[model samples]
Target: MAFENPSRERIGDILASAGNIAIVGLSDKSDRTSYMVAYAMQNKGYRIIPVNPMVDGEILGEKCYHSLAEIPEPVDIVNVFRRSEFCAELAREAAAIGAKVLWLQQGVVSQEAAEIAAEAGMTAIMDRCIKVEEAITMQGRTRKTQ
Candidate 1:
């Protein structure tokens, strides 16, 4: 069976309900897309867990983990910043960690990864920006600045 993303309402629901977001390939650099996106989500009230092995310390004031498995708490979503070719493994990790959603950033899509997520009973969204979705669904809402 082919993989499919949730409907618009479902997407909005996912955005509204999710709290902890594990961002794979997240960078500490403020100029990077990952950092900016993660910052936005953090401002929107979701906990951002940075998963990147290159530089380890703190990013966006949160401790960075090398992988999803290292996170201590349950993750609601796994937001990937890697290329399409890297998604399948990340999907498996997200499922293993009991994440409810696997979100691929814009311009990234992998049918194999989506299928894996579906088989694991996780929602898979590709080629879409999580930040954009939050802004759309949470319009007119004030984000926390702290």
Candidate 2:
């Protein structure tokens, strides 16, 4: 069964409360999509942990984690930048690590994976940009802080 998406408002709260993010499939190259998106999220105050196997060193000032399972600290969000077909595996890892959210980046979606996440009681969001959702759904809070 397909899972219901947590509303953008709820996603805002998740993103707001989330302390660290494990960006799966992140690249070491500065020009990569994962790099740019991670940069944006990092600028927005989210601690983005890069998880690309090819890169032995750090990117964007954060220590690179080889895998989600290798991350010693708690990861509040598991952001998948890979294709839809691979989300299920990532979803399983997220659930095992007790992650609170599974976020599929734009153009990535997997109903099966979402279902698995939901079964594990994790909030599931597919095919959406975290930055965009934060800008739109958290307007009320944004106004208050301004």
By TM-score, who's the top model here?
1
Residue 47, model 2, lDDT: 85
Question: Compared with the true structure, what per-residue lDDT tens digits does model 1 show for residues 15-118?
Answer: 87788999999999999999999999888789999999896799999999999999999899999999999999999999999999999999999999999999
- Report lDDT (CA) for all predictions: 0.90, 0.84
After TM-score superposition, what is the CA distance of residue 122 in candidate 1 from its true location, in Å? Answer: 0.1
Worst 10 residues of 2 by lDDT: 137-146
Question: What TM-score, over all chains together, does every model reach?
Answer: 0.93, 0.90
Tell me the tens digit of each residue's lDDT in model 2 across 74-116.
Answer: 8888999899999999999999999989999989999988988
Q: Give the TM-score (vs. native) of candidate 2.
A: 0.90
How many times do residue backbones clash in model 2?
0
Best by lDDT: 1
